[model samples]
Target: MTSFSYGEFAYVYDELMKDVPYDRWVEYAARKLQENGLSAPSILDIGCGTGEVSVRLAKAGYDVTGVDLSDDMLTVAQDKAQGEGVQLSLFQQDMSQLELPSSFDCAVIFCDSLNYLETEDQVKGTFKSVYDHLEPGGLLLFDVHSLYKVNHVFGENTFTYNEEELSYIWSCFQGEHPNSVEHDLTFFVYDERKDAYDRFDELHKQRTYSVDTYKQWLTEAGFSKVETTADFTSDSPTDKAERILFCVQK
Candidate 1:
């Protein structure tokens, strides 16, 4: 079994994530862009897993380019875009070492993807790379798991999901680093032709820092202004907020 996440998991990603509010994310990005005087701007969808948000943004008339480290995820994203009759420039690349050809009007790393960076330096590098690839005055929008969620929600927790075609046992444990968690997922998927269930496992790790630390890093990476919100709303982040969203201007 592959230890890395998003390998075999990519096949079942969309099915398991059907409840995700992809439209809300797209709306938020569009609203922020319009507020910044960018209408129908070019967008870079960093860590665009399976292209769910990327396809939606393209359908909403934004020029979208998606980049992800996983080839399987990118394959799924490309197929999704083709099925939606939308054109997306998809690339396989690491987010921390991004090197695209053209600058973008806006860049986004949503869905707690930033938390996947285990080290502080990697997160800072991602911010700087994004800053370099964005045009002057361009905005960078991203989100991460709050410290509260990492400690209280995911720490040493076990969750199970069941459906007719799929089931999973997910266990989370405290990682070696502060504000980090390791996820061990065991999946049993129904195979129709074989009339049997195939079992596989994957391990994923995520880490996050305090909001102030993130803000300081963004400033260090050349962002002039950084505004934050909580749980997809415009309200300020409270201690109990689960998701912390950041919008920075370069």
Candidate 2:
């Protein structure tokens, strides 16, 4: 399948993404929330890959519920939550069709998870679904890739990173559309215990929606006020990068 499968990679996800600097993201978001006059008692994380943010929010004293499509990701997330001695609720659910009764004080879709929706309708549906799950005054925070990054920066470049047992090659190509990039990736992993090797390939496609377009969608989803900034640092976007975070109040 093109989507991420739990497989053997589940156990090594955190290690592979060790450079992600998740703590930075949490700290940034927390500061932004404090500045915005919002403090959530409970949070629902949409597309919460492996519950990285979910676990962090739980530790920050918020009841957290994380939802993802990959069973393997959820499995790893559950294990991590338990190992950390923190309680986070995680479930396997499609973003377009979420099934949760408890309305959250706040919801988030971080790490460019919004780009995982492949189509325009899917994106709108996800926004509508998240809108429905929020408390009347709750907030929904999400981010998307920017057009500048796709066209000017990542058009066609390759990077490689290596570890003791597994390594990966990353190649980015500009998509035919105006604001999209295709990531062609390959992974080589060796199991020292089994003395065997395995290879896996993944093609990840990410597209950017204009800032105005996203704000309009949030309004259509019944979000009354929408605020945006170019980066997690709470600065406006420039021509250099393609990441923007949108904060919507329901």
Candidate 3:
């Protein structure tokens, strides 16, 4: 199967994601920074698809830099930042091999972006890279799909979305690895000029490990403190939690 790249998918991403709570993510980052005695900290937004969260952080008066693996997505992000009248430094880079000239006070990987990494080594490499780029007392915040979600919610499931301009049929199958899912999506977008629909297909793979595994990786990467929360709240995750959030300090 071909790997997923946000090529044409970048154009419809924002429209499909209108209900995402981007403001809440920014607020969480800001509040965490303030609680840690960091005011107006510089932020590194890893896997910042379409710049939604990055632009919001900039508007919230934080220095924001965005990184993504897809050039098409970064192009959309650049346009969005300009339209929103926000300044953002954006780059196309793999999260596991991150490299930048300056360090940041906080690094965030939101929207379950960390789940896209398909291997244990990639995830560990990403933690090490983020740790290298953080300043002393810096914070690293990220979220991922819980193991239960990967196994029960996405495994061998089918979903569909219908709209006037766009529609998609999404099917999920078990991946080769444990606790992993491979999503096969077929999209049909209306072509108003041609009075027809154009179709495309994409394949995406996502995997999740347990909280203990992630914490061990953070410790191996030299993080000083680590905390976990569930579904955007400050409570510890239960077995049924769909999302798991991690807050680590360097």
Candidate 4:
């Protein structure tokens, strides 16, 4: 299995992502729903890590269901829903082989989680599975790291972040395939009771295809009206854009 499993990372995810603009992601989804004339939508949140966006959407009055491959992540997400006083239907399942009893009006794979699929077939399979779980005319929204970022930006890069209680050294290496990268991350976290720092290491791989390739796969998976944007904007992606967003309708 790929190291994409959250594992120990789940406990510290929100702490590291405290500055993430989850509200903007929710706003983007809401905009798409209104533009498509969808009302009172039921949402399916694929790869809903830690239930942050899931709970946010539920609070926004959408009936929300979340799914993730990591049991640890789902456990945190379930607790988060309870803490927020919102109801969420959550499950543990692989997105590529998703099986759900009910269909949804809209589905989302946000935060560039789709890039975690290492192969073209896996990406297409996930799209197909999502299509099967959606109603006709349903929408699917997702994002991926742009090819430029994968090939030029992340390739052979090193980043470090330091805080009082948590720190990490992140290194990236070029992958065997085009527009792919492997991440090597080591985290040092303060143990309050023991008053010492504990170290944890995690390796993750991510790959992304061209925008045209993504559109083609979505079409092959029975989606129509597939459109794309860049980095949360309504404009097309440019050479420097780091993220690409896709909106597809089934």
Candidate 5:
């Protein structure tokens, strides 16, 4: 299997995700804060890959600090923030052992980044870290892939994307654990000068636990309240929902 690297992939991350509903994600955070009767002037964004949502939130007039494990990805995020004339504080840190100099009114782990933690302990550690960094009665928001999506939707599936400048073939295989999957991705990028395609590959793995497990971990991490919604909607999840969003308070 090819090794995992985002150095090359980070350059095209925004182009590939141009269709993602980032504005909705920002609005969701705002609505959740309003629902809890909390005012949010500062936020901590954990696992903030490429800073798409982080930049959006900053533009919405919030003080945003972003953290991610990938320096390559953080480089892209910094460039985007500069181009938009928005200031963002970014750090390269592992979410599982997060550390920051300050606390905030809200913290978020959106875009299913939690799935990258392969073990329960890692996830719980991340929750505890977030709890430690939050002000009293602060809020935490996150989303993860539902068990149905991992076990069925991505089970041994092969998908392809083709475009004028780039193309890719992605294959997914079951991992060693339940609700886990490994992704093997091959990319071909057009070289305009040479009139040829340059190829690169990346491998990634993700795991998700049951909703009950997540709730238990949040409680153990000292979150006072935890509620869940499905697929960006303010409703309880059904068995077939692909993603689950969590709203918790410290």
Candidate 6:
């Protein structure tokens, strides 16, 4: 029941996720574009948490529009874009139901945001909404946590890490059903400058569906040529893969 409120940790999200190799993912997408002869003047980044990837794409000379449901997260993104002088258009919106001025040339939903949708209707609705907001022949790339990884690695994982100033307790519990994992995350942050301490607890739930189910949903949502791969490379998904990235065309 601990939805992403982002009260105190909103300012620290980018700092924590900076280690994520988002540039690598962008490179993968760019290579896919080059190989497939896909060129888009503009792109819509759905579920763009803090707009890190969108900002990178902007550095590569693309008009990027980042959208997310959290206003706190969007504020951080706006600040970063202003500070870095990146011309990004960020909006507070939901992926399952979006209202935009016009369709985009391409849309990206990265960082496993698709897993945040807890229900089947939400996933199908999001895909259908994306299809409606894309131009013909446009591309859509997204990633999801793999069921295999959820069942094996994250099912019963628990660990603790303590840095010079801050400490954290991270645990994962198997969720109800065929494809779900619950993250029991607790952060004990220390402000060295003020010798103060604060704590934050978050319970995150993520799920993955079969590739066939996703393809069916994409096809029903008007997407054609739905394909999935392991990691960012063009490889088949396996039991040990962390995430399954889906590449679909409008």
Of the candidates shown, which would achieve the greatest TM-score relative to the real structure?
1
Ranking by lDDT: 1, 3, 4, 5, 6, 2
The predictions' CA RMSDs to the true structure, in order, are: 1.3, 2.2, 1.7, 2.2, 1.4, 2.2
State the displacement of the C-alpha of residue 88, model 5, in Å, after optimal TM-score superposition.
0.3
Clashes of 2: 1
After superposing candidate 1, which stretches have Cα over 4 Å from the reference?
Answer: 1-5
Best by lDDT: 1
Model 5: lowest-lDDT 10 consecutive positions: 1-10
**Candidate 6 whole-model C-alpha lDDT, 0 to 1:** 0.83
The runs of at least 3 residues in candidate 6 whose Cα sits more than 4 Å from the true structure, single-residue gaps closed, are 1-4, 192-194
- Residue 128 of model 5, lDDT score: 96
lDDT of 2 at 219: 84
Superposition error at 127 for model 2 (Å): 0.8
Candidate 3 clashing pairs, residues 3+ apart or interchain: none
lDDT (Cα, tens digit) per residue for candidate 2, span 10-98? 66677778888677667766765676677765788888888788889889988889999988888888998998999988888998888
Q: Which stretches in model 3 have alpha-carbon errors above 4 Å?
A: 1-5
Q: Give the alpha carbon lDDT tens digit for every residue of 162-204 in model 3.
A: 9999998999999999999998998888889999888888988
Model 2: lDDT equals: 0.80
- Compared with the true structure, model 1 gives a TM-score of 0.97
Q: What is the lDDT for 169 in model 5?
A: 92
Task: Name the better of 4 and 6 by TM-score.
Answer: 4
- Residue-level lDDT of model 5, residues 111-189, one tens digit each, is 8899998888899999999999999989999999999999999999999989999888999999988889998889888
Clashes of 3: 0
1 or 6: which has the higher lDDT? Answer: 1
**TM-score attained by model 5:** 0.96
lDDT of 4 at 235: 95
lDDT of 6 by residue, 74-157 (tens): 888888888889988888998999898888878889998989888899999999999999888888888888877778878799
Q: Which stretches of candidate 2 lie over 4 Å from their true place?
A: 1-6
Give me the overall lDDT of model 5.
0.91
